[model samples]
Target: MSTDAERLGWAEQAAEALTEAGYRRGGVRSAIVALLDEQSCALSAVEIGEALAERGRRASRASVYRVMEELERIGLLARVEVGQGIVRYEPLREGPGHHHHLVCERCGRLEPFTDDGVERAIQRLSERLPLEVSEHEIVIRGACRSCAD
Candidate 1:
């Protein structure tokens, strides 16, 4: 969603969003958010820390990890394991901030999109599971249409 404050990028929006969700934010949190946006990829905690350092914005490894864990616990971020020991965090929200991703493994491209079939599937699943699924994101990683050539 486009909030006047949300324009500051994922790191800034994350701090605001988390605070609205009842988490007290600090530099580490902001740094983590920026790192996520800069890398624009699903990254492990260590990778995140390293990236921050490379950008001349250093955050303690422990703190970086803690923020990642806390975000997940607070339901603001989702931990996805796309490969061996590789976990990354992604924000989830409906309305304007909602969508899924198509990750190109070969090209390292992340494409965001939403589809009706996904919505229908979630509705179907909620009926069978008896739990309210607010939103769902599917990361389909493979060759893109052009890459299929």
Candidate 2:
């Protein structure tokens, strides 16, 4: 999750990039970008469409897919594959908004968690290994509290 300011900042940055790339800054793409920017976790295209419908904004499935692809191509979105052929997309960012997912296998809930210990361990492992770690994603899976209960 990101702060309100950070979310807005991301939206602004994405909008600017789209404009600079000869893309217009409105319609379904604008709406999707704004909605995704405010999200705490990655969302599937179905989820995005449902959300937009709930907000009285209509976007077709094809349009949503198109915009998502465009944003990803421009480096504004990242794809997260949470197994079971399910894929989601989140804002691609760095710094304070960075975190990993806690996936609930039972309920399919995705939660974000940040741990300095895990980060430090990764750093140490990278140093010990021969490979340079350019990026990483850690997804912890289990039943969430409610599902467990």
Candidate 3:
């Protein structure tokens, strides 16, 4: 998990990058960035719009998707798909953003997980492989604790 400070730092960096990329600052974009900063898990464009509305910040779903697409293009956001045609977005930080997902196929609950052993194994595998691995994501699907009953 990322600390509030880290998330805020990333949000600032994202806003700067967008500015540098010539994306004019607007209410929707700024609101989206602020909303994303508070999230520990990925959210879909629809969810983002809903969240903004719930917070008294109005943002159109189309605008949310446009901003998300721009962020993804700039490498500030990562796309997460946990099956069932559901796609979500999360910030891509330098360190803590790197982790895998624990998906509950039964309830569609998604959670983040990290392990030093998994990281070491990936490093070893990368050392053995011929190609360069820029990134990787592992999604383990099973019933979450609640659904296990």
Candidate 4:
């Protein structure tokens, strides 16, 4: 339920953070904003670049990838890989219980899932597991409804 303006502000803030982190933000700013405006579920860098190109915006592939990395560093997006080499990028929520995702391997569809139980279990595991867990991602991958149908 975020307005486009709000998303732009978020992107700008993210860009500022990137600058602080020493990553320069350049022409790719529009590409990042366009991705937010489209609100595509989860996109790879190439996919983002193609989306901008469809709208007559010439977002260079390198710029799109750099923008994505900067956005990830600023906590504006989450990077997820579904047992594949391609990393998917999703906008981050400003509140707790960041929704999990279910990914369709064949169709590349992403569906959001949320449950307090998941958070509790993650916390419990962090306490016991040897891994240092700050943030975690959970993705269930399989054929989706339509694909199965």
Q: What is candidate 3's CA lDDT for residue 141? A: 86
Q: lDDT of each structure?
A: 0.68, 0.87, 0.84, 0.72
Better of 1 and 3 by lDDT: 3
Specify the highest-TM-score model's number: 3
How would the candidate models be sorted by TM-score, starting from the highest?
3, 2, 4, 1
Q: Per-residue alpha-carbon lDDT of model 3 for 92-130, expressed as tens digits? A: 755775777898888778898888899889889998899
lDDT per residue (tens digit) for residues 1-149 in model 1:
35634434556667777888777766777767655655433577877888788878888878888888877876667666554446666664555555677776665555667787887788788889867766666888888778778
Candidate 3, which ten residues in sequence have the lowest lDDT sum? 91-100
**Model 4 clashing residue pairs (backbone):** none
TM-score of each: 0.62, 0.81, 0.85, 0.71
Residue 83 error, candidate 2, Å = 2.9
- Clashes by residue pair, model 3: none
RMSD of each: 4.4, 2.5, 2.0, 3.5
lDDT of 2 by residue, 15-134 (tens): 999999889978999999989988878999999999999999999999999999999898888787766777799997776788889888877788888999998898889998878867
Poorest 10 consecutive residues of model 4 by lDDT? 31-40
Residue 64, model 3: lDDT of 84
Poorest 10 consecutive residues of model 1 by lDDT? 1-10
Model 4 scores a TM of: 0.71
